[model samples]
Target: MKKIIYLLILTLFYSCTVKYYGYVYDIDKKTPICNVRIKTIDSLNITYSNENGCFEIKLKEKVKELVFEKENYQAHNLRTLSIQSGEFMKELPFGDTIYLISKNSKYSRPKTTLPNNVYKK
Candidate 1:
């Protein structure tokens, strides 16, 4: 009876957690993006991509979504249902790659000279 209870507990614990492995990339450049932050939307669990833009995250299986963020890149929200449904694989022929779009710098502008009188003040 003790063994049966232990097995049941183990199964329950195993079923509650899941691990995901994937890579981050630049959508336009097709290059790996390192140090991208990945976090579960419903949980505090978080991880970051390595130098190779690869990452592994372990979290509760109940997590429904994941958010990916990086500097100068548009944040992406990935639905876990798509992952489970194999939609991710269909999009990428290779391994899982989460592509991020680079954000255009809104402040980028040609340098302008200030008025000579204003500089003297």
Candidate 2:
């Protein structure tokens, strides 16, 4: 009975271990975006991107979805995130560079005044 219980406990512990992994990048610039805030969709377990725009969060819950947010950037959802697996006891690379679109990058075209309009011709 003791061995059975121990096996069950070990299985449960390993099964719940999850590593949230990804890199954040600027959608337009095509460069890594650092210091981006990443968290579970429910607002739990927050983490930030490193200088290389890489991040890994170890989680006990089964949160497969996350949101990346930053100032002057649009919030992004990594909805296609995968389920937790493996038992190497460490974070692993998942997929894709998470992209964030900057709100401050909006471009407004300058109005061009013709020479004829200035002379009132």
| lDDT scores in order | 0.78, 0.77
lDDT of 2 by residue, 9-119 (tens): 999898887877878888778799889998887786899999899988778865546788898787877753344565433323475677788876543234467776686
Q: Against the true structure, candidate 1 has what lDDT? A: 0.78
Minimal lDDT window, size 10, model 2: 83-92
TM-score of candidate 2 against the unseen true structure: 0.62
Which regions of candidate 2 are displaced past 4 Å? 1-15, 80-93, 106-121
| Residue 2 in candidate 2, Cα distance off native in Å | 12
Q: Report the number of the highest-TM-score candidate.
A: 1
| Residue 95 displacement in candidate 2 (angstroms) | 2.8
Q: What are the per-residue Cα lDDT tens digits for candidate 1 across 14-113?
A: 8887777799988777899999999988548899999989998887654566899999887888866546465543221324888888876343344489
Enumerate clash totals for all models, in the order shown: 0, 0
Residue 37, model 2: lDDT of: 91
Angstrom error at residue 3, model 2 = 13
